[model samples]
Target: MFTQFVQQFGVTTCGTMVWGWHGRTLSSGVHHPQYGDCWLRLLAAPKAKAGGKLWDGPRLAAERFDGRVHKAQMYASVPHVLDDFAYLAELSRAITEPVCSEEPVLREEPALPDRWWASLQTDLDTVAHGTSDRVAVRQEWINRVVPQFLNVEPPQIRHWAVAHGDLHPANLTAGTPYLLDWEGFGLAPVGYDQALLTAYSCLVPGFVKKVRDIFPVLQNEDGRAALLVVIADLLQSASRGDHPELAPALHELARTAI
Candidate 1:
């Protein structure tokens, strides 16, 4: 079905995922006929019934803060009811730059541009009060996840803002630094995104420090509380056998945060 769809646009499939119904890559001819160098990505759309926000976050970022997000070309619907949607978007390639590592890293830093940080802050501000189609962050979810793993009580949240809920090194590109994967973007605690990045970089002291230096919110009370929320979420994911290699590092971070 996807192959036939690509054929309609006269674009060839350059790559496909080995497993999962998540992704496909198409030749750049779909976007440009002459200097067709850009790649197109076919990504799995989030399910509405599953509390997916459908492209609300990315669309807002693209329209309001252009450079912060990759642009989308179109979307298609599948016949099936459950797994029924996909979106085609322009895939960004770093210009002589390093892509973010998918695996957890303890060292090896990538240079992130100052403009990218500015874009992130601007993006967060633009979407801070925007309506979300995904599940809103709740104190109950935090309560359920936190106390089960940590002895400390969940921290009170005094500030709220829209966040790239899955913010981490993997979801971010270095150098130019465009944030990817908006399926989980929604209203979260103000510092939640930075907290997740910090947790992911916890294995690298220098990188963690870099994150702290970039986002000074992590040094405050609300930021510390938000980091606990991220740690709680990570612990929940770890319990399900995801990122088992980072289990030790996650545990250490959780202890310190708590």
Candidate 2:
């Protein structure tokens, strides 16, 4: 079916494995067996069309097994998607060079629907300030930790660029390091991404440190606190179902948060 859809497009492969999770793909090169090294990807349509303009790489068009039209973006290597703090630091410095006519990598928040912010609030309130079950801890965190560190109001989250919303190693790729799966993308403080990467890094070593270093805006303590909130929310929502694999990770996250 894919062959028929991409018949004249010189498609190289179909369903070739690439790094991804949820509904988005990171990188999947379709190598034309007869066309030598010709290859490309079939990226799904981004949740936010405006976000696509911020994408930094080659682009293509793709269709799903169900005949849904999708944009296919190409990348030379997905490994570049991995968060390498050292490399990012250099890139940051290069981009900050004054008088450079090149396209400035705009690090700004994307417009989001109002309801999305409300949904995140449930977790933010539970984690940042705790619920009725542990008001003292929430108070302590707010008075002693959250304010001194995070430095942002719970309702207003415009201090940082748009976060991937759902960030994990699975969303990354080695061929073209594109941050796929924008369904959860939204505006938040810098610590949100750091916290997420830190929590997930417990299962995969070194991811936390690199994410922190690359995005130096996050304080270690604040990042952990923010992460605790996110984990708690994720545990309560996505992992709350009967998925055995996530049950334990969810419990652990909930316990740690409270």
C-alpha lDDT score of every prediction, in listed order = 0.61, 0.35
- Model 1 global lDDT (CA atoms, 0 to 1): 0.61
lDDT of 2 by residue, 28-95 (tens): 43544454333333334323332232232222111110012111222221211223211000000001
Q: How far is candidate 2 from the true structure (C-alpha RMSD, Å)?
A: 17.2
Stretches of candidate 1 above 4 Å error?
Answer: 16-51, 54-97, 104-107, 113-133
Q: Kindly provide the TM-score of model 1 when superposed on the true structure, using C-alpha atoms.
A: 0.73
The segments of candidate 2 whose C-alpha lies over 4 angstroms from its true place after superposition are 14-28, 32-160, 173-184, 204-210, 220-225, 241-258
- TM per prediction: 0.73, 0.40
Candidate 2 positional error at 235, Å: 1.2
- The count of residue-pair clashes in candidate 2 stands at 12
lDDT (Cα, tens digit) per residue for candidate 1, span 1-258: 345545544455444323322333222323334334334444444444322354444444444434434323223222222355444343333122344766544346666677877766665555565555445477778777777766578877878777768777877666556566565676788788888988887777777887788787888887888888987777777788766666678778766666
| C-alpha lDDT (0 to 100) for residue 210 of candidate 2 | 48
Query: Which candidate's lDDT is highest?
Result: 1
lDDT, candidate 2, equals 0.35
